[model samples]
Target chain A: SAVISQKPSRDICQRGTSLTIQCQVDSQVTMMFWYRQQPGQSLTLIATANQGSEATYESGFVIDKFPISRPNLTFSTLTVSNMSPEDSSIYLCSVEGQGAEQYFGPGTRLTVT
Target chain B: GESVGLHLPTLSVQEGDNSIINCAYSNSASDYFIWYKQESGKGPQFIIDIRSNMDKRQGQRVTVLLNKTVKHLSLQIAATQPGDSAVYFCAEIVLTGGGNKLTFGTGTQLKVEL
Candidate 1:
C-alpha cells in the first residue's frame, strides 16, 4: 500500500472563495484521482489528474469549478474554484497501485460558509 | 456511465458479531472491485478487493464475495470490534476511453456497539 497525505486537513472558507488541496504520495504512481464526499451522500469522482496534462473531469464537474494539477507521478493538487456552500465536502486523492488496488489520503475537509 | 451501489445505508451490530455489507454494480464489464473503510474525519482506507474472475477472497479477518451473475458484492467482517465502526464503500474499476477509473458507491455505515 502507498502512503498518501493531504495538506490542510481541515479549513473554513467564505463563500465565493477558492481553496487548493494538495496530495502527495510516498512512491511514484501511475493514475491519480480526486474525489468529493458530500455530507450524507456518496463520494463522487471529481477528476483524473494526469501528469503534465490537463485533468479529466467527470460529469457534473467542470474545470471551471474544480481545477486540477499534477506536476509529477507522486504529487497533485485540486483547486475548488468559486466555492459555494454546496461545495463544502471532503476532498480525497487516490492512487491505484500495481495490483489495481487504490490507496487514499486522509482527505481535506472543506467547509464553505 | 456505470455506477456501484449498496443495499443498506446503515448497519448496527454488537461487538464480536459478524457483519456483512452488500453492494451492487451496474456494469458487467467492470473486472475489479474494492472495499474501503472510512472513519469520521478521515479518508477511506483500503480493506480488501476481489477480481471479477474470483468468487471469494479472504484477508486476515475479512472476506469479500463477488457475484457477477447478479452484479453483487459483499464484504464480511468476522468478530467485529469498535474499531470496525465506520462507513464502508464499494468501488468498481471501469475501463473507459481515458483508462481504468474507479466509480464509488454511496457507502454503508457500520456501527458496532460495545
Candidate 2:
C-alpha cells in the first residue's frame, strides 16, 4: 500500500470556472490513475497520468475536460476545466500496488454551483 | 456493454454476527477482482482480492469467494463490528493501454447495529 494525499479536500466552484486538484504519493510508482465518483454512482475511471507525457483518457472522458499532469513519479495534478453542476463529484487518485491492487487517496469533494 | 453488479443495495447486521456481501460481474475475461470499503467522506480502502484461478481467499476476519462459472463474488465478514459499517464495492481489473483499470460494481451499504 502507498500513502496518498490530495489537496483542497473539499471545494466549491462556480460554473465555467476551473479547479485543479493535487495528488501526492509517498513513493515512486509506475502507474497512477484518476477516477470520478458521482452522487449515488459507482466510480468511473477518468484518465491515466503518464509521467512527462500526455495522459491516457478513458472513453467518454477527454483531455480538454479533465487535463492531467504528472511532472514526476510522486506527484500529479488533475484540472477540471469549465466546471458545471453535472461535474460535481468526488475525484480520487490511486496508484497501482502489488499485483493488480490499487491504493486510493482520500478524494477531493468538488461541488460546482 | 458488460458491467459489474451487486445483489443487494443495503444490508443490516448485528454486532458479533456474520455478514455477507455479494457481487456479480458480467465480463468473463476479467481475471482479477478486489473488494473495497468506503467510509463516509473517505476513499475506498482495499480489503482483499482474489484471482480468477482461485475460488476462495481469506484475510483478517474477511473472506472473498469467487465462482468463475457463475461469475459471482462474495465477501464474508466474521463478527461484524460498528467500524465495519460502510459501503462495500467489488471491482474487476481489465488490462488497458495505460495500465490495469478497475471497473467497480454498484456499492452495497452495510450497517452494523450493536
Whole-model lDDT for model 2 versus the true structure? 0.91
lDDT of 1 by residue, A23-103 (tens): 999998868999998876677888887787898888999998888889998999999998999988888899987777778
Question: Candidate 2, after superposition: displacement of residue B52 in Å?
Answer: 0.6
Error of 2 at A22 (Å): 0.2
Chain A TM per prediction:
0.96, 0.98
lDDT at A108 for candidate 1? 89
lDDT of 2 by residue, A1-113 (tens): 89999998989999999999999999998779999998777899999887878898999999999989999999999999999999998899999997898999999999899
Residue-level lDDT tens digits of model 1 in B1-114: 111223438899999999999998988999899999988777888899888899999998999999999999999999999999888989998655454688888799898999
Best by lDDT: 2
Q: Model 2, B1-114: lDDT tens per residue?
A: 111123338899999999999999989999899999988888999999999889999999999999999999999999999999888999998666568999999889898998
